[model samples]
Target chain A: MQDLLLYISLIAAITYLGFKAYTIFFKKEKSCGNGSCGCD
Target chain B: MKKLKVALIGNPNVGKTTLFNRLCGVNQKTGNYPGVTVDKKQGNFTHLSHSIDVIDLPGFDSIYPKSLDEELVVDFLKENSGNSDVDKLLFIADGTNIKKNLYLLSQIKDLGYDIVLAINMMDVAKRKGILIDKEAIAEEFGVHVVKISARKGQGVDELKSAILLESPEMKTDKLIYLKPENHGVLMNYVKECVSENPYKAFLNITQENRIPEINVKKWKTEEAILRYQYVRKIIDKTIKIDKSLASDATTRIDRILLHKVFGYVIFMFVLLVIFQSVFSLSAYPMDLIDQFFSWLSGTLSSTLPPGSFSDLITQGLIPGIGGVIIFVPQIVILFLFFALLDESGYMNRIIFLMDRLMQKVGMSGKSVIPLISSFACAVPAIMATRTIENKRERLITIMVAPLLTCSARLPVYTILIGLLVPDQFYYGISLQALVLLAMYLLGIFTSAIAALVFKYIIKNKYKSFFITEMPSYLVPSFKNVMLTIWENTKSFVWSAGKIIVAASIILYVLATNGGEKFDKAETHIMTEFAQLPDSKKDAMVSTYQLENSYLGNLGKTIEPAIIPLGYDWKIGIALISSIAAREVFVGTMAIIYNIDSDEEMKITQRLDSEINANTGERTFNFATCISLLLFYAFSLQCMSTIAVTYKETKSFKWTSVQFLYMTILAYVVSLIAYQMLS
Candidate 1:
């Protein structure tokens, strides 16, 4: 049960991480300069 | 109804933005025209039951744009010319500085633009005892004159009514006429070249480099000299002012504010107050937020069914997000002060005061504005360098703009200062506040040196001139300040949230579990501490767990590279992770240190209590703290700033130069600081 919970947490974290990476690199935010890559 | 497009044109600091805010209220959005760095703000509002689209053109001395922003403004205007969408032009000017602003007004008039001259700051002008013959000026310029205080909302309704008076056909049929310094000499020549607005033809001729034109006059002329002479004649006839009162209250304020000896002293005092206030005022709310997050983390750990998933939520996500959110108080406060200074009309005075000192280091007074803005963030600050027309100076400004300590460094600084610097008063000021001020000062000092270095190395031939106007000081508007604070706070939260949350989850997953090596190490630690107290044994186990975890292995691999600077593997991990974004350092440190019980144990407390396994001494001593501070102070840990530099310069060469020099400087300086202190 402990190992199962750990695996579930890992999956959830990796999914969120994937989404974050996609937004940061692939998505273009309107504001360019505060901290995000200057794609505005 | 489709909005009627109107261009609100003006000189700098003439309340055009104030009028724009009044007209558009909350219905506006900021944008940039394609391929230009200049910010374009377009908004919609109802004026006399007709929906209006207002676009603000950047301020410039002459229509012949010397800077990129000015060039874009010209392009935007020409792009919208004669289009039914853009039918009216509102020319805004400081009523007192009508003489100076008339040069642009004359050019617009010569282009046969249907315009209403919105003379702002009339209330301030009236107080100073300056008077304008509105009827006479209106008759002289062949345009409607609206004397409205945009801040007070006086006579804006009349201005809206006048916008409708101009027939729509004038927008399309306007002829451009070129009025030379001596119109008598160029009349015959002008008659032959007459087209729809000969001045438009003149603009096309002179600005061929911008508008792309065929053969036209290769005219090298002081067109403004002629226009100014025309403006003088008009002012001489239609404007009246008492000569003695002309200097106004600004001169009186300048007497002390611009004094050579006291100016620097006063400036330092102001900075001390701003920093001190930021530290003190934010303590309560920041404490509440911190404590709440702590309780939340603790509650989750106890309430959730005992498992790794519960541990992940309690130990990782809550603390990681809290690490970044705790500094929001300071960010909001710093920006509030900046906005207040700007609205109070004192920021320009700061630039003026710093101009001479700045020029000694190869920066213009204009560079000061960008540098000041850099305190909030580098990307926008770097973009602010658009006003610096001299290519060399602008490039130098861009290169050193990031050297300033921005809000991203705030969390790192606050945490370090809390651990290293005692919370005591030095001469009635908080010691931590003084240390914070010193960090900002260090940034300015290093940037100056960097600017000086760039001045001699980068070569350029474009002429540089400083032409800043000292607008009359007014009480800052609270509405404006609140709006500014809200906008900046929102931007800071959104941008910082994205990276901090991502890095937290990634670091958590990496830190909690290692491979077979971690399992072996954990079991061995459990066996070794079998006879110890539960608390001590658990502490040892957690320590061992971090040492053998996946993130731990990575940190150990890099520990040798950082050991000389008094950093262990945990600090190494943080230093590595924060390269994603500087603010992530705090979150990285929180997760790596294996902190779970968020009770009253601040990150500062955790860092303060850290002990080296071998030496058994406190890990974050004076030498280590100073070295860490200097490393972060001098390093280019922000990816956004690099992206901006590349985008602006369109050269990886300059970006690499920026990244390398800053990194090399950080490493060398940190090594020296650590070695010296130890």
Candidate 2:
């Protein structure tokens, strides 16, 4: 059960970072300032 | 509603922005003007059944283009010259500098545009006992002159009404034409090229536009000389300065402030104060922020059912983001100081005074504002490079700006200084404060050297002109300063908050989950410490898990590369993660070391007690800390700055050159520091 949770958390974290990267670089949106931050 | 287009054009420091802010209020939008990198502000408002679209053009010195940025302004003007769509040119002139301001107006007048002279800073003029005969000047120029104090909300409605009520039929041929005695060839060429408007022909008689190069230079020089000679004559007749009503306050103060020897000393002292304030005064708020995050993490860890979700928030996310958000106070303070300098008009004086010295280093006096602003953050500082007309100097300023110890690096410095550097007093100064100031000075010195190198390397054929206007010093406006601080602080938080939060969670995952050894963290620590207390046992488990995790192995992989810098695997991890931002170094260290510890200690205490696995020596020793500092000082660490550079230059090639150069410089410098210290 513990191992499953750890894997889930890791995947979630990585997915979040990937989303951020996509917004910052690929979307070419102003992800840094004015609350856009590319997190979407 | 149909819209009418008009541009607000002026010399620098003429309150054009103030009037634009008033006209647009919350209705302004910024967009690039065609192909130029210069973003022009477009605003809209309804006045008396008319929807007005106002385009505030960047300030330029003269009609004759000196820089590409200035050329864009002329290009916009020339395109709109005979076009009926562009309604009017609202020429803003400084009341105090009527003559020089009028020179630009005179050039515009010669261009045969329907122009209105909006004389700003009338309040300042009135106080100085300098009175302008507006009607007389208007009659002389054959243009409508509206006296206004744009800053004080006085005569603004009148000016707006003047723009709104202005008819298309009012043509001003108000400029005095100069047919200099020696320039007969230029006059004849002007006569041959332009059949309709002789004024337009002479004004724009460029070498490419049907004139010889030699004749063009002679004609241009004569034109400027003639304009100034005409301006002097106008000033003599119309403007009056009452010496009794106003003492020469700015000049009297400038003598001590701008003294050749004293000026540099004063500048150094000002920098020393700013650094000291940042390091010493920010302790209280920084501590509160640190403690709050620690508590939040502790509460989440205890309350969230002892699962991965709990660990993720407590260990991975909170520490990661809390590290960056904590530095907001310092960032605000830094920007506030800069705003004060600018509003007080001392910023322009600094540029004026520093121009000669800066030229020696391949930077302009204009680069000073951007470079100084970099001490807070580099994104806006690079944006501020637009004011620098020289492309090569602007690029160099943008490239070297990050070397200045920004607010992000402040966290890294403060933490290390607290941990490794003792709170000893040296010559009546706190030793830590001295070290912080020294780091800042090092950044400045290195940036100077880098500019010198790039001066020769960066190829440019366009002439670099650094002529700057010296504005009279005034009391810093509290309202304007606060507005500036609020806007800048918002941008910093929004941008930094996103990266810090996302990176934290990701780093947390990297540190938390690992292969076989990490999975057996409890078993390994439990067996090794059977008699140890539960608290101690838990700490041992965290330490063990981190040492055995995927992150731990990854750190070990990079250890060899960073070993010469006196950094252990743990430091290597922090170093790698901190490439996202310099401040992330502290939080990465915090999350790795502070987990499961009962006592809510600061990251500084944890780093101080952290021992290296190989040698059993303390990891954050004097040598290691200094090496890390040197690396961060020279590194291209902030992704946002590199992104901004790419955006500004619109070239990946220049961006890569900047990144590679800074990284190489950081590595070499850090290696040297570690070798010398360790």
Candidate 3:
């Protein structure tokens, strides 16, 4: 059960990071130039 | 519901954003200075059984745009003129300064726009013993007028009612006319090609250079003179001012705040107070957060059965996220002070004071705002360069903006500084705070030098000029300051949290597993330390395994290049991870050191206790900490900032040059600092 949970969490973390990198690099956010990058 | 699309038009520093916030019941930023709204913002609200979409355009003084921000408004007007894309223009004007505002209003009227004049800041005008005849102005301009105080929320409902109730047929007649005989053929060509409205057609022809005989420069000048003449006449008839009751408070304060020498002294004093407060005020809350995370890590480690999964939770996720979560108090205090300075109208005077110095570096006072805003983040600061008119100046501003110390760098600095610098205070200001201030000043100094270099390289035909409005000082609204702090803190945590957690998991996996050497670490340690106790043997084995782990091999690969900078494999690993985001450096450190099931020492304490195997000395010595701080100060380590620079400049050459330049600067400077100190 512990090994099973570890694999599940590892997969989830990988997927989450993959999705985030995609959005940051590939996804063209609709910027009307309102500083929506949350960096503001 | 019926829909109405209206655009809010105004001159700068006239409370347009304040009114927009009131109308939408959402907090868009409002400052007592010009160029606050550099981008068009859209918000919607349901009122009087109609859904109204309001477009808040960046402010400008006249139809002819002086900056990219003002050009946005001109572009919006040109696109919507006589096309019915926009149903109404909600023209906001400062009641206390109606004369100068009327100049722009007169120009807009000539374009035949359907407008309702909302005279804002009536309370301020009343206090100054200035009275406006709303009916007379309305009668003269042939548009509806509403008195309002957007800050006080006094006339927002009435303004909304007027928006839905005003007739659509109330378009203003032309205030400036072109003779048909003098330019009949040009007018016909413009109307057929660009716009049917005569003034708009003339404007398009002149702006596009379609007709050389039109004498665009002469016409624009004459047009301005005529509009001002008409505006002066209108103001004389419809306004009254009593000189005796007018207040001189702003003038009196400006005498001291804008003084030649004392101005800069006061500004430096203000920065000192802000940085001091960031350290003093955030100490208790930061302590609580640190203790809480430590408790959580200890509890999870003891409660869960010892396994890989338990290790991941206790070592990877908890420590990683805790690294950034602990700095929330400092981030909040920094933004809170920034918001207060902006709302109090002191920031504009700083711009005025800095204009001379900025011009010496080949930038106008306008670049100061973007550079200052860069202290928060480079992405938005680069976007804020739209307010600058000169192309070369704007490009330079974008290039150097990332050099400023943003909130992301705060965590890295804090952890490193806390590890080495004593927490002692002198004259009621902590030593750590003074170091932080020096780091920020170092950023500003370096950026100015870089700007001077770029100014000599990039060439432009257009001249740079600085124009800003000094707004009346007012007490900052507590609600607005708190909202800014909350929004920024929430955004920082959410955005950095995702990256830190993911990086932690990947790093955890890397540090824990390896090839044959890591697998045999326990056996080798047991044989070498046969006489040691069981606990010491286990620690030796963990250390041996970590040194042979996959993460260790990767760090060793770059160890040769970084060794001159006094960095080992672990510091090299953290440096590599920081390229993802600056704050990730702290998270990487936490994950790298906290992998074993030991007592929950704070990350700072862990780092302080770190020792170099080769030298048998502290890993993070005075030389390494100073070198690391200097490196982060100059390095373009953020992918987001790199992406934003590309987006803003749209040139790979510039972006590549910026990245290489900053990296080289960081390397050379850090190398020198480490060598000299060591």
Q: lDDT per model, in order?
A: 0.79, 0.78, 0.84
Model with the higher TM-score, candidate 1 or 3: 3
Candidate 1 residue pairs in backbone clash: B175-B197, B176-B197, B176-B198, B176-B199, B177-B199, B181-B226
Give the CAPRI class of candidate 1.
acceptable
Ranking by lDDT: 3, 1, 2
Residue B167 of model 1: what lDDT?
32
> Which lDDT value does model 1 have at B58?
82
**Comparing candidate 1 with candidate 3, which one achieves the higher DockQ?**
3
Error of 3 at B103 (Å): 4.8
Answer with 2 or 3, whichever has the higher TM-score.
3
In candidate 3, what are the lDDT values of residues B165-201, reduced to their tens digit? 6543433454354433546665677557764777777
* Descending-TM-score candidate ranking: 3, 1, 2
Q: Which candidate gets the maximum lDDT versus the true structure?
A: 3
Where does candidate 1 chain B have its weakest 10-residue lDDT segment? B167-176
Model 1 stretches astray by more than 4 angstroms = A1-40, B1-95, B105-201, B204-247, B529-531, B596-600
Which candidate would rank higher by lDDT, 1 or 2? 1
Task: Give the worst 10-residue stretch by lDDT in candidate 3 chain B.
Answer: B27-36
Task: Considering chain A alone, report the TM-score of candidate 3 relative to the true chain A.
Answer: 0.72
